[model samples]
Target: MSSAGSKPALVASSSAASKRQAANSPGGHVDKRGRTQSNDEDDDEGNDTQPVSTRAWLSPILPSRNELITSPDDLATLLATLPGAEARVPDPQLTITRARHSIDSLLDRSETEASITAALERFIEAVRERSTERSRYPIALLAALPGCGKTRMCLEVMDRIVPAFCSQRHIPSLCLFLNFNSDAASTWRSYEESARHPQHAIARRLLQSYYGGAEITTNRDISVNAALSLIRRTEARRQQVLEQRLHIFIAMDGATRLVGAHVAPQFQEPDHAGLSLEQANRRFWKQALTDLQVACRSFTTPTWMLVAGTMSSALKQAVTNSRFFVLPVPLSPLRAVYAARLLDIADPKAPSSRLLPWRVNSKLMARIDQAAGLPRTLLHIIDPTTFLDTRSSVSIDDATLERVVRDGVQGSIMQHDSDFLESEALLIYRKQAPVFHPDISRVERPTTAPANLVMAAMMSTLHKLQGPDPNKAFDLWQSWEAFCAIITNLRILSAIAAHPNSEYVQVTNLFPGSTSSRLPEFFVNASAWRDYSEDNPDRRNQPVDGRVCLTPAGYTGVDSWCTVYVKDNNGEYTPATLALQAKLDQVEDCVPLSTQIEYIEKAQLNCPSSTTIVALLTTARMDKFDPSDVPPNAFILPRQGYKEFVACFELIADNVWAYNPHLSSIPRLASQFYGKGTTLAQARAIAEVVNASQSLDPKKQFRTIRDLRTYLEKHARVPNSGFTIQSIPKDAVLGWPYADDLVMEDSSITR
Candidate 1:
């Protein structure tokens, strides 16, 4: 029905509140007093789903969450106390902030000029090694996306590193905080410098100290040009002071004293203050480093200069290989890391479901991860007060995410909007788009799982079904209606789901045709109609059908595509070919063994037999599938297949009874997916692989699926319990009689 790939999913969940409040509250609690959340308390159990603003989440984290010092005033005191080689309160990497703060205070506390003067004598003990000795500080360049907090972190560090003096008599040493942007700080300019105006307030304050009798008045606005002249006069004075104090001259330009301008020189005097033409051109690149070198050589006191910026391509040229060593801040999967780092502070009792779950889960995460290598989306899904009860643990369940992403991207070139394509896009984009596809999400499933073989053995039914199940249209429709109601107040599915307090579904009701209702009147916004996309995408001609399909450029401003990545049996990830998966499945929704093998061969995949079995089983069950240029075993199997498939597994184990290869502990594999693992799961994957081959029996090969799943949920490096399935019905599965006898539970899925 759809094309091989599709658009990146939409990200509508703003969580502006989530981002703003995630940083502090006392002991990990969020301050919810004045916050106005989009979802109301009534839906705390089963109703409202709306996308909140980003400021809700961002503002909290962005504000200084200095775990070291409780309050801003206490910060200085805490910094002055750090002692010895190392002392880590919680996280070790931040040990430097404590040390820098503590040591600077000791310098400021000096009573006598002798103590200040002897501070240089203390340098011998601190400089244990030269910059060249250890490449360990390979320039801690923190590579991150915009607004990921690098700049804020630099400011926090500077606040610790640069000491502020308390005495009025003391002229503080210059501590520069530079933004790679080529503009100078406005505060750096002096007032009254421009010919037409008065000076700035701050400039007047500084002038009071510089000149005793200067009484600057308030209210008169200084023109920018006038301020520039005064700033230049002061700059000239500073230059003279520099010449007087440390005579070994450093040349600079008359234009930009900083890095943007080239150095300029006076032609008449051989000993002129200005730089020559040759030096002028390169000064923009060299002044900061040159100054640091001079400060290091001439001053006894530790001269700490904190320089930060967006990592422009000009870095290689801007930084040099001299006496200075740049420390690199290791880049991490920060987006993914945020779940463990933030969002736990949501209020549990405050009517709103304390945390927001990505409508998509790990499978979605993997898909997005593979396709775009970023978690991004366009719709901002907001979840509030979802009830974890009998029918559904959460009102907005995983099936919705599966449908949205898999359908959204798998059918990239679909002639229609509702087409579902087989794709690996959602997982790739999940992390980057925090709201739509979160860095982390809660796994939702039923309480009990089906019996011993096929899917039951693996216990990944719900998790697996959230991806490719062919008979999911009914559920998708049900959920889609529920979604529309939550976002648009239709309540169509809610009425069917036995909502006693809710009104019936009606067009006028969804909009109320008036302003009295609080719900977002969906139809009221006529812009919601698909009129804009009724044209063809080729851009030149209309489609054969009277309707036209718009290109990405025409419909949406950006183009979204999918990239395929594969994990071998050894679990190494590499870019894989974008082959259609359905062809491999043989059945449109299922990947058959032969086709999988053929594609694997073409892609040169060298995976173990177990992975092959899982992949084959997983493929045959998809609503839409394509052969990934991937190994047969990489795909996790659907839970419903556990019993019948495990029967095959049992048969395979019989043949390979004595053919013991040095297999990694199967319990270890299970432990990776969940936590605990039974001995039966040890050979489960291998058994599944062998069972997938024609010769193996079903039971022997599939016995340990449940154990494998349990282990996976508990101990894998990145525990992905999403593969564990639990909610599917007996009749819908392949081995009906067996499923019926050992079924866990049945609801709308049973029929």
Candidate 2:
């Protein structure tokens, strides 16, 4: 449990500065950004302990079988003896919860725990063979949200599962763990230096440990060969070691540093020194990592590489663009039951030790659920310094627990906002003026939207809706209707909140809008029931469903115009100048839709943008709605035999921001919108893929788009859905009697 050298002065003091040390150092306090904060200026001059070697500090040697730390418990204990081990590894005393599946687990088990275990076993089998196929090697990227236990999972498999599997076959499994943010790796400027240097922080410890502290040299090839060579030489020493071959697993944590601004790039290649962080990342992944993986095949031993990092756009892009075969295993959030066990408030090992006030309490479960199944958030809530006295057996009331949980959730959200603000670099100008603003600089750019609070708000609403009281639970109609009413509002607000230039981004209502009433809260807030007038000159006189207005943080000038599309659609989607009409009652005729199209056509007049006007008509119930009655340039909701009104909000959410209107495929939209047996969970997956596809090249997306079209065409519901074109009256106007009162403004339900 101990290193040969003495500890550094970083965490040796009792002073306040010592407490601010980074999370990696023992006794170091983690800052709001999850980084260890240290005061390097304050040195512990009194310490006389011998300094640890550069190699040891940079790369800690992997623990061998001689240590007898084979189980997860043993590994956890060993980790605890190391500085900041608690921050890096999960406590073995707590139950290890399997991460949720990103895609529908019913269809794909590749991300499941069983799948990962099988993959690890396969790695061991590959190691046993003298000449294994390169594809047999496990090259995985364990991706997850911050605090979702990516590191813990890696350690568990490496330290416990892999070793156990290898032991049964009499094969030795060795792991060399590296953290990019470690003292050694952080100082590395270029990939070449990191890979080539004899004392390279990336792999020196791995070499020193396996070669018994021998001086390992690098060759003309990429530096991974040093470790690969060590494994190859193991065959010559097999008689002395008493093993057939070695299973070497290389795990790299904090890999996000390699791609993003986490590390200050010092390019060794002269031509690349001036490249941006993003460009540098792309090249590093496409070339450096690819070469490293390719070099792995040159060696004989079964060696797999597991790169772990927080899920981010930069990390995802790097992995996706890489030519290397890397299976990305994203960790899902913890379930409430598992989270409860972590808190020791439910399922205690001993019945006598279970606290009476908290043991399996429904209120406690509710409080834990507020964390949205994130273990880190739960840990924050249970942190004794912040929330509770875990040692206390005294009675704790529900109200106190509720407050603690609420505060923890809010704190997590605030931290997210703080991080977003620090990284955001755009100017927002609200759309207040009627005339199109000539200043192009004022236009708001598409940015990372703040989704934490929006999700938290949504979770809270869902919780209340499905609370203990049966009466509060939503019926089928209530669920779809309520969701449709406010989803657009939530989407727009979330986008504005994340925009760096938005003015007055604040949480006015915990639940921003409710669906109890007929009209959405957006219209109600403006004291109108049917529609609100947009400041844009072209649509100034037109009464629309609702509009979201956001001004730049410090300016009153308009930057972006987000016109809410509250109605239904046609084949192509041009989000700009689009209008949506929600039909709660049955659609008995096409007159209403015809009138709506005329109004939108009039609004499209003299439009400066190339984007065309589109309209979507949504209805929960429709009678005798003939395929021939549908209007051109318009789309009808619940196209015969489809009843997924609730899931369709995902489409609306994707297109809410009018600034970037990606003309998504109609077949793809329909596949997701009316795909039989689609659940809310599946809808979320579709939305994510749809959003991601927007950034990809059109040709690259052809496969996915074609697949979705195929699915839509083949589904049972497609047979009855007609596609005949119908033309509406050219003179149709917005003066239809029923349409006038379709959307009305009432302040009675205003908050």
Candidate 3:
């Protein structure tokens, strides 16, 4: 792709400055915060010739095909509006909408309590601290590849973070979270539009949840960039009180523009001179901090907040490390994690066999875990619930645990067929399937309507409403278009990996080369290309109108074929049937509860929530568990506050957090009482750091907080009023986690 002209963002460099440029340019480097480079990526060294757009490559990995109504049109609108001058119309068949949905689904399904709690703790500390020696970055960027738990982690964080202000009647403190979406990549909503505009929004209502009476300001003029501007400006008002103390945590999902955006605010654009395309598009992120400062200076008290965004590593690293903050959260023992959750959930029901850490027996499962490096994938992609259900009862036996590993791996593999089908279908839909495409007339087929009904319904809902996005109102990420694109794209990839001639598919015209072919081609080489014996003009490459077209096997009715027997056309359809039918001619009026629920949850976690979460929820008729019933930690309240008839209501907060105090975001006194083993580890790490930092004796300092404070005061600033008793990281000295991230040690790691 040619470098376009100047756009809105100011940060520069989509990837970090490194000798090893990230394999995925706009994502993160393999060695950075997001994305675990698959082995396949390493084996291929000369991939520079491929497309620069990660969306293009990753689009095919999704596995759905519901044609979203008006979604493509909305994307097209954005494409047209971005500052870059481009008549290069997006492929009408492009499933950008659905691609978004798929990503949201995968991310939403994989959240865990521990991951969520830790992120909140870290975020809260960032909000409270002002020191410079420590990394006091307000933007907590979590980047990862597909199936990684970054998005899930954000949800977990919101669970804690939102309540911070909510409990204080300052719920609107939650700021806007721009879903870093490709479809929306071209054009952005203004600060006001983003907060309450219909269509894939993620804030405002969240504020209402926390502030109770907070309403979407009817007179407000919020926009897409507003949240970012707010987050970037938050630091300026860190010490402000009242309205100022209310922070806006804008969780941007795909902050690919971080680098450029961050830099843009700092760029001194001559008042009369327009920024170059690069300056606006890529350089803005570096100045994001400045733009934010400029925008936020006018707020009442000034909103002190953070930008909690989910990005791929390449995208995350694009910003200059010296200018911004980045955090990499690696996957831990997932089996152990899942086992613990399952044990908790199971304990409430029946006698259960003790669940153990899931040790994989399958090479594929191990390979996958090693490649993705996240446990959420195992949970969602593998469908742990299904694995557990296979038992004679709900319990996971030793045999069941072993079997789960095998089944989960198989599930991941089975997904390829569907994955590829959706991918190729999207390619077909974009280039080969669009009725208006030059090649559309070449093949005489049934003409039902102008749009895919199911897709339309899905997209319509997504574009319908974005409430007070800042406040975590309905902070979900799934939308109709995003879901369709994700599922369809994934299906396409699955198909590509499974094709018999997968080796030669890429070079072939998108549609498989022959009618006899069961799968589409996957290779990108002419030398490896296999020619079809009986060439159908459509299947083989040919110039139609102007564009040369190859009908990829999964596209143009190949995968959209309806079953021979139609059960009923009354509009009621089974997913099995929908999966087999030709693409819908128009939007479906209703989506299933199960599908809608998934959509809402995903939307809650992605950018879609920014615009249309409430609509999505209303349309789906979805119900959120009472905040008190949700997992991890409930919003803590005095018993009198939560009185059920002043008698019947359960004290959910104590009930839930009591089970896993680790999940609580509030700094509970109990956490200070670490287990012996945990304490030992903590003490050891502290000792090492302190020893190195001060050359002090551990025994002497261990005697009293005063002695240690006196010793550290010589080299550090210890607050006079309060006494802190814990270890901390060197980074925490001025940045995050207040003083707790550091470990006091007789010998510190002189960071």
Candidate 4:
């Protein structure tokens, strides 16, 4: 779950090697059976469950297996998988790497960029029109999350696609690519000058790129006036050639620079300027676009601009959806298929199956998935220096894998830790520490600042939980462990909440302990057992009873919680703090939903912020359920819905311990727990089964929950046809005999 939205699912698979190597391999031809076979191997039917990863599955397809791969390092180097390395600039033809290496593929956003090529060509053509409407042509705005390959996509269009289009139309073209990032090949001094005179900075870049390193002795030649004069001079020169129109394509990398210090100057405009920084930035960029268009019109030279930037709030505010065509680059994690293909190109011999399958080793897969499919992060995680083991058969041990992942995650978090800290503190500050609450208070709020309040709440809670002669000193590791525990539980709750329609029972004890006495390991870290640290007993002899206050989730720190951006049906995401309370059925201590809502409302009264407080109450027994006890908006799961409930736990556990890459397609792992749609279907199905039962008892519908489940399974047995009951129309769902007959028929099929 990225801040942008839940990312598209990633497929994990493996391939033998790159296309060039595969093509030259001995006996690479297909056999009479139509399967690619080598001279050294005998033919065998491929496993359906574990399909071999082939380069044919790749976007810019590479061929099947390469026999050259011997180690993981070879694969990493071949793919140029290095963390923190920005996208490389492609050659003018866009068919090769900067190093002049022949490259037949662009993996990341090839489909999207290809699809938008026509639109880009139209934008260029529109700007090049001989009519006066050139001034109305807006600059193209490309938006994407960080590391989504925006720069690479923009470069492809400007350097390759546009040039091709111009050549086909017999138009002369010159492209000036301006990268404003500090480390880019841009003029860093000129970017600094943008603070005062941005137009001059643009003028200098234009002159610099146009001259191709020729000495422009005077500053006057690089001024705004000189830039327009140059355009006029070029247009007049081009007029000598009959019907030849000069098209100037300009691409601005890191367009976010336009909204920085340059925006303050725009705020001074009398009537047209906006009051806020975001509005000022928007107005400034729009004026910049208009100014460029107006300048181009002065010489009747056609010009088109492409601005690319990350999904920053300021960028979102500046680019109006109506005026400019906004293209969102998908930054989903690498799916199994992509991963498999990547491995194939990298090292064909490296064991990919162990790494790709979610169920194989979840903790390891989770770390790989946490890279969020960004090339930099993925490279960092699988970097040969840390990940690949050359000692024996390129195997990565548990200890080394743990360290590598921990370091990789640390590196990722460090990049955005400051932003995460600020956002998380803001969330807690907005909670306002309910007035008159037993543990929290208004006095705890700092008069001078809100940042310390988060720390205060954490420390305060830690002190209470410590019990008797507490360790007052801040232990960073202990604090971190507690934080992880809090985030893990909140994520579990959030996943369950996502599917309110589903109900689950039977909480599988994840840690090694007495199931009844011990809480989930995620809820109780080793630090919590302070007194018996050396022994580290599996479970405390005493009942696991206590309240644990936790901080709200943030973008960094905890991997599972970091990118889980769960949004409501209304398509709005409000970061939340979860409070969970549970009781055994014999305990009869379940809290009502209304009281929980009241507590939240009361807190909101003091500090009205977007932050939400979610409270969950669970019980071990379902037979004690009472209609009057359940609130109208609250969801209660009977024992009959226990399968779905347990599925939710399994989903969460898989993600944390062992992830099933196959289930990544599910929209919200939480909704699956709630049986959101599944609950309604189950209810209707059960009602249908019970109503149509042969029993004469009128209250058969009110039989024991177990009996109802039995009737449901016996009557409405879903066919094993790779489709859920939810996928079938309710009217078409037959009961008993019909369902049994369909199941039998489905079993006979080849599938």
Candidate 5:
């Protein structure tokens, strides 16, 4: 009996070992004895009795599957369970230290040197004065076009002047740099979260600035109240140093962002519907400004705020309304010498000899200054790595230099970098609009139209007129009349679009008075047309076609004029013949000299004796036309005359859309007219136009005009194929005398 019991025990031990091995294998099972069981045995056990659910093997310290968070609510619940998770506070000392370091870093990166020191000194002077009078804090507003180094100037002032002031006076001073671009509240909140021991945060940031090796710390959660408390503590400490008053220098960059955020609801709301994007942005800016104001006021420290940006009128108003002592300092472009020095510092790796070539040439340096007009822009254009080509032994040529300058300016304008183009276009439009309507002090803003569209339209009009094969040319008188009509129509449409609230009239009803009354003041003046008619009694009776009529001089009178009418692709009439007298240089093919001469001689023959016919030339110099090539009596009016005509148009268009509600649609219009498919072809065209206009070489302008003509031919619509003349009854005195004379001759023959 003992041997049999021993045998069963041995078998049971073997079975247990086998089960344990099976449990350790993949997809194996564990029995109640903590021994592994094979799949076959488990299946057999399942067949014999109900199968038990296996518990997942989990470590005691690890979270169970049920406790795993899958949703935001679950995560929140888990966070809530942690100690001090809800009331995580940021340390104030870290925030102030980081802000100071940021200002320092900006100063360190700046390439500006002695050139910006004047502006820095002014800021320093203002800060020092603030100590003398607690209520008389100087608010210096540094205004400049974008890329003019305003930010760099601010940084340099803070870094050099602030530290120097503190050391000179042996007094404690607080310098705070705020970028209104970032949300003030959220930034503070982030600082609060990231705040740790003040020493550690400061040391870490310093290390990161110096060596880029510091590990980033997590932001500590701090309440708004805690932040305020820190500000209050700093303020109290600042007040204690009354004998050596704590001079506060607060520099605010992009102040436009701050003031715009707090614009009132009335300013934002449109008459038709909810706020537009522009209005919405303004509202946001107004609110942001309010928040910034509140936060700044909360600090009891006597502060001298230095605000800088391209100050908009709205921002200017806000600043004035706030009762801040505004000391406006306008930043101008650096002198060529100063700019060249800056370039040297910006690119230390460049060969000193190679760089000297750019400085020695006064013309080249002047060109560079004109091209960039701003320090930051110049730096961007002449980036050391990209601008300098070490492999090429040849020095830069004038053409290459010219090309670079053109490219830089065009690129800035095309990119709307610093809002340069938009501001320029607006200025041009504003200046031109008031000449047409002297009573109108301000142009209505385009609500639907965009700025680019307006610019493109203006460019397109110029392109058409200046193109190789310009619109049809009528005789001088006829051409002038046609141009007037076209301009008037465009102005009316623009006016209506600009001011939606203004009264509307049909195109036919635009000029309710007589035709002569409808003409612009320049045209109505008899002296303006004295050369064309030469005091002829029957000037109005001149034939519309190239046929000469009997004037006071006679039927073949020398003073008689003939006009050639030309229409543009849009079927708009313009005085193309007015430009006929303009000199043609390499562009003779566009207007053959021989053909023009022949036409002029023919018109002279039909005119009375001593007519002294003249043709207006668009070329800058009349010398382009050889004296021997034309009749002795025929004179050529040079480009200066053409400019005068262009000036007239500019005056009429200035400020027409200054306040247009549809001003935003200009970009879209430009895109539609010049853009290729959905791409940015319009921007390229505009850049090319700007480049051509700024080019010192005249050949580039000619080429640009030719290219523009080709572009318009490919893209613009053809003129409509229809013609109808509508005539209204005119007074007998103003009517054509030739028609009356012909009627009398016919009647005499019948009698």
Candidate 6:
């Protein structure tokens, strides 16, 4: 190849020009630019002189297409002719050995559990001894959830069984690994049409194990059937040659995909008109599995067929019917010791690294185990590369470890498939159910649909909910579950409300106490205001404490005028400042606290002269207060309440239903009562009653109380005694858990 554009032109000397001129004169003429011009007339007349370009003389000789360039010399010559090709040529040995080393490293890096190793060893020994009828074919099924290392386990088994058989029995084992999930076999099938044999591509992979890229005899074509037959024949002939058996181990990873593929409606034929689509799909999968089972049985030698994957119910049933010896190798979360070892293997310095002392702290190890013990989860939590930087001393303290654990758990939950969320959520609920319900079996468990819905809602909330603290995300999850539990019980009550004979009682009856009888407690000390008012009879000149206590109902007074206050941060001991109310729920231009303070100063009510501050408390998550918007001396606490406020309001709403026997039939009412087009006030009222009735069951009541307590402990700012129930926002109250006006109202409540 020409190197004209590949390199800069060199300056020529007079000595080089003379040599070029002398060399060109006999064969051809040289142009001024040092280009060789062939004498066409002389060449056509059969002249011995032949002309070659100056660039051609400098170019390396290349091998022809017909030449077999196997030697290093030939390869070098061929590569040299291509521009910049010499730079691209890697060490031949390294290039050839890379795949082999990678395969070995994969096996070496796999952290095998002792149980897995022992099971494989036992199975292999049984197959060797031919101790049972099942050992004749010796098919073992390994099942696990995804990312739980089923594939790695298969590799580990092969790594052990292959060597053991070879060393002890003096027999060579052929271990074939096929991953159906990844289409490992199908990928090679694409090349079969052009290959000399049906199994040519597969045989090539097989040959790599024995030869490691060294030239092998490939003139003879071998099909898959022929390869298996050859293995049987070779084993029979081994008696005469080495007196050893030829053990053929065929391991299929992701065997579940085989069933999944055939079960998929698109892959099944609809030729049978009598059969439904589902039936036809199942039949196709059954046949495919039967064929695989038969193929495994056909192997006559001491053969081992190992299938591993996330086994579905259908797949498991099919395997059992085939009479395969099922050796369950379930992958568990990695133990701390194994995780540490894996980390060490991934990064040799990880075990000693100060930054990631995962092994040093037992508490950290336990936390990691709880957070993500699976191989994939652990790796994701602290990737090998994360500890690669050695210049700076890195330390994973308790806080950092906690964050990592939280991140890993959150990621695992989020990454889980929606179809599996119900089961995962059930697992979480089961752990807590025993504690909350002593008679867990009797407690009505949530169905898959509701559980999945709750999980989805929680996930959506987590995605949108933002704050500075990472722990808040976890707290949100706890609060969400509590919310879900309460709603679930309420839904159960609605279903129960279909019956007319169900008794309805007051909210206080459940607690059975005079003190806890009321839905919400209100406390106020009016002595200061009363005493001040008596001293100055003129209302305009009297001092007010501004300490009036109001329940949710009291907040919306019969009169248009309402009193509100800004509490002093120093303590509730100092008198509160009176303020003007701008909005309740749906009023426009709801003035900010700062703007309201200005309004209070201008519209002074009948009160003694005193510095007043505007204090507004609502269920809304308010923006951070701007000091510039208010006076410097003003105390403004925004978003004072947590989600507990919503929970409390919901509880009060439930109480409305419990005390009002007439509303007991709300669940049976028509759509108009809770349907779309219903006003916010209407929806809130209906929802509270319906939900309260639903939550009246003894079990439900207990669950609600427990969930409420937990929610309060995590997110509530004040004790139950100090807190007052507030009304829910009109827009927020109409949902599935709450009553929508689209639902019919029961006129029976009026009775």
The candidate scoring highest on lDDT is 2
Over 4 Å off in model 6, which ranges? 1-132, 135-137, 181-224, 230-244, 263-292, 295-299, 344-371, 384-751
* Candidate 6 CA-lDDT value: 0.33
Runs with alpha carbons beyond 4 Å of true place in candidate 2 = 1-111, 124-132, 180-199, 204-239, 242-244, 261-267, 270-277, 283-295, 316-322, 335-367, 382-751
TM-score of every model versus the real structure: 0.28, 0.40, 0.27, 0.43, 0.37, 0.37
Order the numbered candidates by lDDT, best leading: 2, 4, 6, 5, 3, 1
Give lDDT: candidate 5, residue 444. 26
Report the lDDT tens digits of candidate 2 across residue range 330-406. 46655333443455432232245424333223333333333434454455444424313211222222332233223
Ranking of predictions according to TM-score = 4, 2, 5, 6, 1, 3
TM-score of candidate 3 versus the correct structure, residues matched by position: 0.27
- Candidate 5 achieves a global lDDT of 0.32
Give per-residue lDDT, candidate 5, residue 561: 36
lDDT, model 2, position 35: 65
For model 4, the stretches where C-alpha displacement exceeds 4 angstroms are 1-104, 108-111, 124-137, 182-191, 194-196, 211-221, 228-244, 262-276, 279-290, 293-299, 319-336, 339-364, 384-654, 657-751
Residue-by-residue lDDT tens digits, candidate 6, 695-727: 423233212223333432342244532222332
The RMSD (Cα, Å) of candidate 1 is 27.1
Query: Model 5, range 1-751, lDDT digits (tens) per residue?
Result: 0001111110112354344323322243354476764322212112311211122122232222223222222222333355544342223223333433221222112334342334344444545553333123435676554455566666556656565765775655555455432323323222332223222222222212211122223333222222222232333333444412454555566655443243332222122135454444334333223222322222233345567776355455455444333556555555333454555455444446534333322223323423223455445434534423211222222222223223221222122221332222111122112111111112222332333332223222222221111123212122232233233323333333333342222122222211111111111111121122323332423432212222332333223333333334775433311112222221111234455566556555553323223332322222355546655444443333332333323322211111110111233223222311322443334323333333333233212223333433333333331111111111221111111222221121001
Superposed model 5: Cα runs more than 4 Å off:
1-135, 180-244, 259-300, 344-356, 359-370, 384-457, 460-576, 580-751
Q: Which ranges in model 1 have alpha carbons more than 4 Å from their true place?
A: 1-144, 156-285, 297-301, 321-323, 331-338, 346-579, 582-751
lDDT of 4 by residue, 176-210 (tens): 55555423334345335544334445655554444
Candidate number that wins on TM-score, 1 or 5: 5
